[model samples]
Target: MAPNDFDNSIHDFDTTDDGSGPEPSPELWRHTPFTAFVAGEDTRAVYVRDHLPVLMPSFVVDFALRCTEFRSLPGHIARYAESQAWGSAEIEALRSWQRKLVRAGLFISRTELYTRAAAIRESNATPAKIGVIGFSTAGDRADLLLRALGSFAENVQTHGRAVDFLVADSAVDAGHRGRLRGLAGERAADLGVTLRYLGEQEKRLFATELIRRSQCRPEAVEFALFDPFGAGSAGGANRNALMLHEAGSVLAAVADDVLCELASTDSGDFKLALFSDTDPYDRWVFADRADALEAVSFEPRDYLAEQEKLLGRNLGDLLAGVPVNEVNVRKLGLTFLHLLDSGAARIRTTHLGHAGNPAIPTSSFYAPHKGTERELAAEAEIRYRASFASRGALARLATPSVGDGTVSPGMAIGLDHRELLPPFFPVLPAEDLVFGATMGACCPGALSGHLPLCLRHETNGDNAPLHPGEINRARQGSVFEFSQILRAIMAGHQPATQADTTARMQKLGRYICEFAAQPTLDFREALHRIVLTHESQKIMALEHALFTEIDAPEFWRRDIRDFLDHSRDRMQHEDFDIPYELKAGRTNEENRILMQKLIASYGRLLEDWPAIVAAAWDLRSEGKQFSASAKAD
Candidate 1:
């Protein structure tokens, strides 16, 4: 209790000269514990005195994650991460490393980012190019496109001049073109927008024409068109981009199954809201209107009160009245161009959210980090049903985003000026992730809104599987429907600029090419090594985001064990055999060669991206000039 109660100097403490080394002082047992209890070693003597952290072994973090019981109330690993002064500093150090790394070269470094932003300002972009692309390949989806056009028509009818577009069709089929032309003539007045139709023959011609005009290599043009055996989606999406570019629109895109559901009610808005975990493509609501709202949000008190009422708080008075800020969200029908204008993100493209059914696999549940991993199909169905049914918008809006982390493209995201981006790979699963990664690296901004991604509806109901063992069937990960994070790892998602992304794609292309060049038995092993390193790095990025970017510790801690369990199981299983099996017509050897060629196209596209973009810009300029000259004449 007094100043003289204990000696102040190290000389007063007890120690032993064991000869091996000076023994720790007898007072060593009292070091701060980082957990509720210690099941393993909790203390260690200083080996490197220079470093300030005096925490226990590194596995303690894992121990915290795996802990079945929380002996200490109200403190999770995030809390433990904070309680240690050294840990806080260490985290800050990691955060600083990421901020520097992300800014310098994710896709483009912050320097290049600012440089491009400045150039845009200098050029004073000619009224942001925005268009809604509906590339219909199937003759049957005409009705769906018509429905979307109906929405567009209504917007124009409601707000004149706010909606205007011109569509061009160079139809190859005489009959189809004639019909389309007559239909356009009839509908143009009502729709308040231009309408175009490109049939199968026209699409093929356009593909060849685009290839020829761009001066692409013979192989690239061949690959883009024929794509023997139908091995890729690149041709179609590429066609969609070309269609939009030719028509002079570059913003939103839609598919056959997708609907552009603008509200007929007063609360109508393009509810491509932003959810922290996903992008803003959950539900479709769009109009031909452009007005700005405050960015980064400025919520009123009534917002919280309304949220509480909706969430069933104070149930006694359920019908409580509260003011709603309609203006804050009424601008939902905004184009992606407007979002970009208001500084949402400098993304090469944007992917909106979806609502029907999520785009993923049932196999995702095959290997989960949760304790209920082996739950029966009935149980899992309940959970899944509950998840899909939950519509807690109030809580979702209140939940803030993790700074700068990106969500991959939703099912129906907007794509603009496709040639400006590197080509998508032919054989790679989850290839869009690689494309998105490169795009994100180009700019380090992600718009935060209240929404979600993917909207595929369930093929089955809450009942049991129609067939025996179907629900609990052990499906392989090799299927095309699943997401292989490895694709992103290959594309160097964490850091790939236009130049850098091209180099990485080229490198991977070379690896694939080399793998197929010879009759080697180590195909799987070779691919394993390449993926292993980046997977580790991906995990590190996840940790960096969790510890530094987001504030919800309890909500995000579930991801810590994801990589850990992944490492444990993948080593025991040959999960790296990415193809899993041979293609129908080819043996392993032939398939490898086929894969190499397909992958090689991606590299070539990346290499020619700058040229492709320059050519596209020039064509757009020429078209604009031609219009101006014609007007003057």
Candidate 2:
């Protein structure tokens, strides 16, 4: 048999033989006594036997599970039965009983297998810090609540981490009653995380905490809160009514305070993730209160959306902030830190405690335009321009008119383009303006153009242009209009690939020669294309690899292939336009980096020095090829 064909039969179907009807084997169960079940022997039995336990309950569950078309195999049936610890003919009897229960609405409408699996999870789980409070109802609908409580109880026994139970509303019913109380009891007994059910009372507690913290520590706290409740009207309560009055303001303020307080705590900065059904809770409250809280509503049908959003938001915020000098960020793991720091942005804070100045304040220090929005706009514009100019800005006026606009004298600009800069730019404007202007003025010689404001002359050169706003605008337009010319001449990939690496490389080689044939290169355009091409390639490669199965191992390769094949019909474009796989192939530069690191870490692991030398040289050759190809294509 061929190497790839060795396991050809592994997934093949055999329909040649007649199938037998489903039935429980009684002999399998008779071997075990009832006493064995009570001692937790059942859990051990499945592992020891390495097969399905032949018993009543488990058999019933497996049979019901087998009702799904794909689970008709006898081995699957046996394993499913064993996982549930079922034995004997009684398994079938129990299965029948469960089916009847489902029909009667005593058990859930789903298959018995689902309930059993859930029950198993309940039995084995330890208390977790968070709970899922989904759409609620009474009676049979209480099953989810019970399952949640059971998970908490089971896990909390030996754990110290806090746990929270969830309560969410669903379309099938109203909210649960006394559910939070019940969950709270279970949590307390287990000494796990507290179970909180948000309501008026909870809101009050959160608000009070917020007010207390803010008044005491001032800027020490901050929050990013999303709508804590479901989205809709606030039930039409009179704004002046005691219950509704100040609710939005009070809640928002409290949320903000709590955020700051939690962040200030020695334990570590923490974020509160919340979902609400009311307008104030979801919008007005969090928006006005916790500037830091990044709250998103749970989708109409998704009970856990809030939970997912919370985890994502909190993790991202924590990771991106200043590294706690005293804390071990590595302990949280890079991925977790990345999630916290780079995920959905929560907010960015600087100056630890200056009662943060709004990035866009409505008022100004001067009169007239002082309070108008235009002042804020101008202030913001200055920063914006400063940033775009390489954060190197200083006041400068355009030279008045150049002989051919080659260099205008009216552009008497500050050393830095600082004056032209908008405040939005983060870098200091004054210093940059001077440095850039000076550099542009002199290359290798004495002075070229008159220094608008000479670095040494405290007052000379006053005739230079006083405004460069027009110059700035002209420069920007020149860039856009000549972008293509720039790409052809100036743009080139760095550390060019070697020739003869791949067909792709050969094409790029040709493209580069064609481009270079043109006369003079626009240095500015070249620089821009180099950046653009590299970025475009990076994005394309990442997306291509993520959507392909080219590098996935055997275990998941088949599934991935199937998914790709299935999705092919939906693709709007053809293969020629699709990006090639971005595999960390043996010859890839990124992979080479890893290899070098490995060699450094375990130098002794390389048994042949000559082989290593040859490989490195080969890689360098390949890189040259790649670079040449990039230029062509």
Candidate 3:
């Protein structure tokens, strides 16, 4: 049946006053289970139900199995059947059985959900006020800081896992935070953007959220790691490799497989300097969890400016040392997909219905802010139309012989010549293959030395030109007109079917005469001639030699020589611009070269007359590349 035969339903809910009572609520459109076991809730179900079955019958196997006891379905019982009919009783019974099977497990199915729960768990493991890492650039340096902070969270002094999201939020002294904020603001200003740098309040909220979501607890540590450089600090503490690895790992753990990159940082040595502005130890205070350790002694600024420059360079060098792995990024995406759901399902479901269902409200007041029912339906129709149009275009370029016997394997459609062909030709595989052979013969090959062989490619100077195959099917048909005339002339001598033969002869004669009147070959005429020409000259020569040359060896040898020379001269003619006929393209020249080589094989007959002549009869029977060198006595 054609695609147009399907009973397609276009659900365009009438918003105007038709007053057919309240239409099915958009909630009913909530994707629901078609089968209890398989989540008929997914979008794949909609595709299978509405489209795939019509296009690809093979996909129906999964659906059939899901809905029926497909394995037990009866096969044809030829022995029991007196005639070809299966009978109405059997058909009815089958339909009833199929209906029962479909309804048996039609609803109340377990729903499949993406396993993104790990993401929530990871987010809760961090202890600090919220950690903010820039998605692209600041990511790497932010990663380093997180890892160093993770080590501290893991230490006995700081039961790292006790913190939420498995990350230790670094506690920066007020002076440092202020400096970082100032730097970030300045950079943001230079870039002409408003800066909302993380302050105490934002940090506290972020940390609280992380703690609330923690799934696991680990060992804690002493100090937190911070990417002061990433924060836009021109001269401050620098983050290094160890910090990045730890931070990256923790982030990955919390992200539940979301891919992340490290950000850049500045070079500076770690200093436990106590300043009157904001003493690091004095400013430190735990607002919610855990106690602080005893203060260690700090050194005063001795080589502040020098150390800052050296540290900046060292930090840059350290960051430059770590190369980002692209494979890691790719792996991260795959991991994320894996974490979503099992992707190896043979069959899947999709939702196509409107909003009402609580399970899948595809169209709610808030969801899919596209438009009204009519508009959406129009859009769907447009997509469907566009898909079919593109499919047709691809079919044209990819498979011109879609319905013809010549359909290639790459084409989805398969054609049987027995079912479709002109009534004039016999419905035989050999006959169809012969048609292909005839087409193939028109174009000459580089290896085959004949005008009617495969195509050949030839180079001129910088550019190469293709010599077209000799067999033009239209021309061959015209030549067949001439051949039919010859066939009639031969049939005249025979007594059987003389009148019928004569009429055919007359028809053929008229065709040939009409074609002959038009002195030049039309494109179609040229094509026909090439197709029918075959290896007629060679076969004729061999046949004539067997009959006449058996009586005169020397005479036969001389005739062969003359034939070879004449053919060679004709093929080698410099004025023969076969490229013009071929119409040059990338592969045209190659085909022309094939033709030249094939025609050039006749030169081999002259080189080794007896051998080539001997090989000629068996050559067509074998599938191989063959050539003749030169004529020899």
Please list the residue runs of candidate 2 whose C-alpha ends up more than 4 Å from where it truly belongs after superposition. Answer: 1-174, 183-200, 208-633
Candidate with best TM-score = 1
Look at candidate 3 and tell me the lDDT of residue 226.
27
**Model 1, range 282-368, lDDT digits (tens) per residue?**
222111101001111222222111111212111111112311111121112112222223333432344433333333333222122
Clashes of each: 28, 111, 110
Q: Residue 178: error of model 1 in Å?
A: 11
- The Cα local distance difference test for each model comes to 0.34, 0.23, 0.21
- RMSD (CA, Å), candidate 3 to true, equals 36.9
Best by lDDT: 1
What is the C-alpha local distance difference test score of candidate 3? 0.21
Q: After superposition, how far is residue 36 of candidate 1 from its true place, in Å?
A: 30
Instruction: Kindly list the per-residue Cα lDDT of model 3 for residues 157-196, writing each as its tens digit.
Output: 2321222222221234555444444444444344333223
Return whichever of 1 and 3 wins on lDDT.
1
lDDT of 2 by residue, 103-197 (tens): 32221111121122122211221211122211111222334444444443344333432333323211212233344335444644454444333
